[model samples]
Target: MLTNRQLQILQVIVDDFVTSAQPVGSRQISKKDWITFSPATIRNEMADLEELGFLEKTHTSSGRVPSEKGYRFYVDHLLQPQIIQADEANQIQSVFKQQMIEMEQLIRESANILSELTTYTTILLGPDVQQHKVKKFQIVPLTEQSAVAIIVTDNGHVENRLLTLPNGFSPSDIEKMVNILNDRLTGVPLQELHLKLEVEALEILKQHVKTADTVIQSLLNVSTGQKEGKIYYGGKTNMLNQPEFHDLNKIRMLMDLMDKESQLQSLFKPKDKGIQIRIGSENNHMAMENCSVITAPFSVGEEQYGAIAIIGPTRMDYKRVVTLLDMMRNGLSRALTKP
Candidate 1:
C-alpha cells in the first residue's frame, strides 16, 4: 500500500513518462504544480519506492523509469479518465451519426479515426456473424422455382443467400418450411443452426414439404453461411512513430504478429463487460512484452459483441486511451444496433 503522498508522486512520474518517454528525475518531477516538496526530499522517496520494486533505472547512474510492475500498479491504481474536450467528442460522434450504406465501411473509418486521434495502433474486432443468434428469418419468393433466404440476427446483422427450390415444391410448401424454421430456430445461434435443422426442424420439413430432404438441405445451406470474420486495423505503421519501438527487431515482432490475423484474434482477452488493460509483459505474448493492450467491449444484442483494442508502447497515455475506447464502443453499439 502507498501513502497519499507517494501515490501522488508515482502518478506524476507515470503521467510524465507516458508523455515524454524519458526517465524521470526529481528536478523534473518537482516542476509539476502539485509537487510542493523539495527535489532532495522527492529523491529520497524515489529511492524508497525503487526499493519497494516500483521503479527502475535504465542506466547505472540514470534517473528512474517505471518497471513493468510499476506500470501495472499505475494502471490498476493511479489511472483516471482524462475527459476529452467537447469539440473532440463531437468530431468522433460525427463519424457514427453519418449513415453509411455499409457497416464494414463505417468500422473501417472508425479504426482510422481512432488511430489518428491517439497516434496509436488500433484494431476493431468485428463480431463473428457465425455466432449471432437468429432474430428473424424470411423466405421471399421470386418465382415458383426460386426464392431468397434472409436471416437477421438479434444484433441487426444480416446475411442472405439465393436459394433454388427443388422441382415439385409449391408456394404452400415454402410457407410451411418458413413457419417451421421460425418456430424451432428463432433464438438458435447461427453456429448451431445446422445441427438444429438436421435434428428437429428438418423432421418437420420432411412431413409437409415435397422433395422435403432436398429443399431442407438448401435452406440449411443458406441459413448457415461460411463467412469468416475479419479484423479492421488502423495505423498499422503508427507504432513505428513511437520512441519505444525504435528497435528494428521489436518493430519486426509487431509486424509479424499483425500479419497473422488468427494470432491477433488470440491477443484480446476481455475478462468481463468492462474495459481491460494489459501492461507490458502482462499480456503473456513475447511480441507484446514491450507493448500495452487496452480493450473495451460493446454489445449489439444477445451474445453478439465486438471490441476496440488500442496497442501502444508501455508508456501509453492510459487515461486518454481508456476514455476514448469507452466512448467509441458505446457509440458504435448505438449506431449499428439502433433502429
Candidate 2:
C-alpha cells in the first residue's frame, strides 16, 4: 500500500517519463506545478520507492526510472479516463460513417487509423468465420471424379473446397449429400459443425446416400479444416521509431517475430473480452520484454469476432490508447453488425 503522496509522485514520474523518455529526478519532479514537496523531501520518497523495487536508479544517472513493477502499479491504479480531442473523435467516427461494404476493408482501415493515431503498431484480427452459422451449402460438379463444396456463412462469407469423388459416386449421391447437409447443418456454427455431423448428420446421411462413408468424411474435413481469422497489420515498422528499439539485436528480433503469423497470434490471449494490458516481461516473449501490448476484443453481435492489439514501448501513453480502443471497438462492432 502506497501513501497518497507516494501515489501522486509515482503518477507524475510515469507521466513525465512517458513523454520525455528520460529518467526523472526529485528536483525535476518538485518543479511540477502541482507538487509542493521540496526537492529533499521528494528525493527521500524517491529513494524509498526505489528500495521497494517500484523504481530503478540508472547507473549512468542519479535520476530514477519506473521499473516494470512501477508501470504495472501505475496502470492498475493511477490511470484516469482521458477524453480524446474533438477532431480525433470525429476522425474515428468518420471511419464507421464511410459507405464501406466489406468487413475486411473496414478492419484494415481501422488498423491503419489506430496506428496513425497512436503512432504504434496495430494488429487487427478478422472475425473468426468458425463462429458463423451456416446459411447455405452448395455442391457444384466439375469432372466425373472431382467436385467443389461451398459453405456459405450467415454473415455472407463463402468458403469453397475441392473434393475428389469416390469411385461409383453418382449425381443422386451428390444431391442426397447436399440435401442432408443443408437439412441437418444449416444454422450450425462452423466450429461445431464437425461434431454435429459426426453425432447427428452421419446417421441421416447413411440412411439416404449410397456412399455415405466417403461423403461424410469429406464434409468432416471441411468443417474441421476451415482457416482461422486472418491478421491485418498497420504501421508494422512503427516500433523502429521508439527509442527503446534502437538496439540492433532487439530490432532484428522484433521484426522477425512480426513476420511470423503463429507467434503474432499468440500475443492475443483467448477470452480477452475487455481491454487488457500486458507490460514488459508480462508479455512472455523475448522480443516483447521491452514492449507493452494493449488488446481489445471486437465482436459481431454477441459473439467475440476478433481482437485489436497496439504494441509500443513500455513507456506508452496508456490513457490515450485505452480511450481510443474503447471507442474504436464499439464503433467497429456496430458497423460490422449493422443491418
In terms of lDDT, which candidate is strongest?
2
CA displacement after TM-score superposition, residue 257 of candidate 2 (Å): 1.5
Tens-digit per-residue lDDT, 1-339, candidate 1: 888877877888888888888889999988988899999988988888899899987775457888888889998888889989898798789888785435666677889988988999999888877777887888898887888888877755677777877877787887888888899999898888888989998877787775778666776775445444558999999999998889999999999999988777778746679999998888898899999999987765555677789999999999999988888888888887775
Candidate 2 per-residue C-alpha lDDT over 1-339 given as tens digits, one digit per residue, 9 for 90 to 100:
999889988999999999999999998999999999899999999999999989999898889999999999999999987899999998888888877345667888899999999999999877777888887888898988888898887765667788778888899899988888899899998989889989999998888876677756777876665366878999999999999999999989989998888777777644557899999999999999999999988877576578899999999999999999899998998887775
lDDT scores in order: 0.83, 0.87
**Model 1 CA lDDT for position 4:** 80
Residue pairs in clash, model 1: none
Report how far residue 264 has shifted in candidate 2, in Å. Answer: 2.3
Model 2 spans > 4 angstroms off = 134-152, 156-226
